[model samples]
Target chain A: MVEILYFAWVRERIGLPREQVETNAATVADLVEELRAREERYAAAFADLSALRVALDQDLADFDASLDGVREVAFFPPMTGG
Target chain B: MDIRVQSAPFDFGAEAGAFATGHDNAGAVVTFAGIVRDDTGSLQRMVIEHYPGMTERALEKIAREATGRWDLKDCLIIHRHGDLAVGEMIMMVATAARHRKAAFEAAEYLMDFLKSRAPFWKKEITGSGTGWVASKDEDEAALGRWSKE
Candidate 1:
């Protein structure tokens, strides 16, 4: 099981903040595809992959990054800090 | 080095004075503060969201990088998350070094990294509506200036 978190509009679109999903996906992209297939809300939240950024275990990572042994995944739009 | 991520507001003058006094041996101290801007005059409040664990880690990494790249005597970063009224301070960064050039450059470097690299998102709530603040391309471009140096 991997914990998934969504922030900003992604969270609003998905209607929640975090969840635990049981998956055997090879990478972040594969996991995204799995979530997108589960519901329309997920599809809408992830419709534009280009607008999103991914993090694995609290570190910024690419979508193609391997999820092996990873425990947490976060999906959000580009940061607008400072 | 000091990094703080909190929902409570901070006193910038006090913090700046404390930072400067704490690093009295340093020849220069530079500080920058960002306030919630209501450019349209319709903005009611700004909401900042952050990934808790990652936010602190990312900030620490940026501060560490700045210290490593410059001859810094001390560095401080304080960022607030949660709802904030217009004109309220959103964040502040301070850097101290042996020279004015290093202090100024390090502070700028910290701002550049914090603007995009940190895991914080801003939502502006105005009289008309609430929307996520889009990341500007110019801000991304600003980062390029540091890479070659």
Candidate 2:
């Protein structure tokens, strides 16, 4: 099972902060596609991929990156941290 | 080494001094603090929200990346959450290095990555209503410049 985490507006939109899901997806994009198909809330949260950012196991990464052996995935808005 | 994400206010001077302690090889310590401004114009207050687990991890990753990129002795990052008033300290970053160049560069690098990579969101609460602050494309572009160098 892979742990999926959400943050900020992404969490607000998805209505949850974290979840553990079993998936057969091999890449971040595939996982996102599966998530988008789950429910309207998921679709709405991930509607515009351009406005979002993804990280795998705490490291910044792209959507197309492979998720093999990845234990965690986090979705968040373009950061406004500093 | 100190990382705090709290609703309470912080003492910038105290934090900076603490990070600079016992570092004889460090010739310079650079610190940067971000303060909430009344410049939002219509907003009376701003609410800063973040994902607890993911936020901390993201910050640590950024800190680690900065440390790897620069020759630094230590670094500290503190960010406050919840409602904040104008002029209150929002965040602070401190970096210590053997020279001013690494210290300054690392501090700036930390801020830049924080601005574009950390998962914190801000909302403006005005007399009229509340609205999510739009992420600026310029901020992303600014961060992009760093990757090229």
Candidate 3:
């Protein structure tokens, strides 16, 4: 199971901050597709791929990147820090 | 180098004074602090949320990159997460180097990276409601200038 996390408005829309999902996905994009298929809330949260940023195991990563051995994935809007 | 990510308020004067004092070998020290602004006049507060583990890691990475790019003697970054009232400090960056140009440029570089790279989000709470602060196109464009060098 991989721990999936969401932040900011994505969290609000998804109705939770994090979850553990059992998946056989090969890449981050595949995982996102799996989650999007599970429910409407996930679909809404991930509707626009370009508006979101992904981090794998706490490091920024591309959606097409492989998720082999990855333990965590975070999805959120572009950061507005500093 | 030092980095702090916390929800508590920090004393800017004391921190800046202490940072400058120990860097006597360095000829210049520059510091920049960002304060919450309430241009609309109705803003009650701004709530900041961040990915805890990743936030620290991202900050360290940015700081390391800044130090690597310049001849910095030392650097410090302090960012606050949580609800903040108008005029409250959101974050600060300090850089020390042998000359003013390096210090100033390093500080600016840190700010530019911190704005977009850090995994923190800000939500503006006003009388009407709350909304996430949208990322500006210009802010993303600002980061492009650093890559050429």
Report lDDT per candidate: 0.96, 0.86, 0.95
The window of 10 residues in a row where model 1 chain B has the poorest summed lDDT is B17-26
Residue B57 shift from truth in candidate 1, angstroms: 0.2
Candidate 3 lDDT over B14-133, as tens digits, reads: 999999997767999999999999998999999999999999999999999888888799999999999899999999999999999999999999999899999999999999999999
C-alpha RMSD by candidate, in order: 0.9, 2.6, 0.8
Q: What ranges in model 1 sit over 4 Å off?
A: none
Model 2 spans with C-alpha error above 4 angstroms:
none
lDDT of 3: 0.95
TM-score of chain A of 2: 0.97
Q: Model 3 reproduces what portion of true contacts? A: 0.98
Predicted complex 3: CAPRI docking category:
high
DockQ, candidate 2, vs. native dimer: 0.60
Interface RMSD list for the candidates: 0.4, 1.8, 0.4
Candidate order, TM-score descending: 3, 1, 2
Task: Evaluate residue B3 in candidate 2 and report its C-alpha lDDT on the 0 to 100 scale.
Answer: 74
Q: What pairs collide in candidate 1?
A: none
TM-score evaluated only on chain B, model 1? 0.97
